[model samples]
Target: MPEGTPELSAKDLRTLIPEYEGLALATTLLNPEPGEPGVRESSLGGPLLWPADEPWPYCAQEDHWTFGSDLRNTTEIVAGTVPTVPILQLFARDVPGLEFPEGKDLLQVVWCALNHEHDPGPVMPLLYWRNEAEVVAGGLLSEIPVAGEGEYDEDHMPEPSTLSPTPTDDYPSRHDLPEDVRDTWEPRFRSPTSGGVMWPSDSNVIATKAGGWPAWIQPADWPDCDGGHRMEHLLTITGDIQLGDCGGVYFFHCRRCPGLPWDWRFDCH
Candidate 1:
């Protein structure tokens, strides 16, 4: 719902709320630079085609749960230097009426490792990829093993960097809404800041932090599967471009649920 966008009227939301149940909340405005036409953008550590023989994803949580312990004095494993700003990327097959799962394609990447010292308690480092080319040619020749390695300090490993796509006019807008959410759904949806709104549940007005973006409070249920059904609303993932607050990272799926390890779900706020 990106170009022009403005169609929400189930009789003007049943006249503001006569038990309205048409469910209206939509937004999809992401342009991760580099030829933006249909999601193929990058940022968090910019530059990816990775597979130089895999093995670059480290957390090894001990107490380094969410960017604590001086996060290796701001990454590159101790600031040996290499990250030129990049902390979020969203691509669920370029989003635009997402359905996915049938050749599989999805990617949500995020990374932030610059703390200097205090107030750096929101360490960002999230990755989820499920591109299929025969499951990446059978897991790109295996080499996975590095979790908690004797408790940190190998220079505090945390590699996997390269992302490019920096173009911004600060997209996502509904003109700074928040006057009680434009007095409750602004006469029937269209202002969760324009490019952000999807409510099947998880109430939402945005407020959830931890590497930010992910809020789906209240019985948003429908993310546990056994192939019963119900779980579809793919696309939200907004922290805009990362720094701190401004939540939203909701994604769900269940194309008909079969393989792909129980469809998808990346709830946030």
Candidate 2:
């Protein structure tokens, strides 16, 4: 638990609903606030400690556009690929519980900020795991390419913010609950004032989180890797950035597979 975060223990909830006893999962809530964070620090939408020698990533998807009535910034459409923007940078030191690949201590998330109507996910995000020491040893990329004005979907472009990683226990949303468990608890989750059934979906923190279950707005859609192993939730991006109609982007990885193959899904309210 981090300081000043109101104590909302899932363990206590479990005492009232024993069905949740075996469903609690350990997770870290990334409480992000607008600020300037160093490249090497754990941050949301902050500068990355990228190797200077390595080529920066760009979105070559042909559908990339910058002009549209629906877009936040409706400037003239730009031609060719748009540079992928930084969304997150995490240091193992800041989040010790995070499982980094062997010899890797840093995790960076960058993505194409433009919309992808044809694709399932709104933003085509990418993940990178790196060694902090090796990046510094090689030399850091001083100038990272960014999407020029009107080149990105403003709703998806997050402002740089520092992170306060707070450890906590998270239980699955009612949708992810076992059929029997949901059936037992659903009827009891009524609101006294409204006299309407008020499901505690937000009990699972709907923020940028690591591990635990996803704060799903709809039915849970867990993806599987080529190895046939069910993927584990790696990270959930929300709150700090406005996705499609207050949606969330989820990242998942399969630890059982070599190289930890990953996938993503997007859901909106």
Q: Each prediction's TM-score against the native?
A: 0.30, 0.87
**Residue 11 of candidate 1: its Cα lDDT?**
45
**Tens-digit per-residue lDDT, 1-269, candidate 1:** 55545554444434554433323344334433333222234333233333435545543222332244575542323332222222344444444333455554655443333332332322334555556344446454243333332222222232323233222111112322234544675445554556634222222223211111123432244465566675554444443334333233355555566653333233223
Top candidate on lDDT is 2
Model 1 poorest ten-residue lDDT run: 165-174
For residues 1-269, what per-residue lDDT tens digits would candidate 2 score against the true structure?
12333332554467677767688888888898999999878999888999999888987676665547664654444435688989999998877767889999998899888766466245668899999999999998888888887678777788899999988888887678888877876467544455555455446878899888888877899999998888999999986677657578899999888998999887878
TM-score of 1: 0.30
Candidate 1 — which residues are off by over 4 angstroms? 1-52, 55-77, 80-98, 101-103, 106-130, 136-138, 145-202, 205-269
Candidate lDDT scores, in order, read 0.37, 0.80
What lDDT score is found at residue 29 in candidate 1?
41
Q: What is the C-alpha RMSD of each candidate to the true structure, in Å?
A: 16.6, 5.2
Clashing pairs in 2: none
Q: Would you give me the overall lDDT of model 2?
A: 0.80
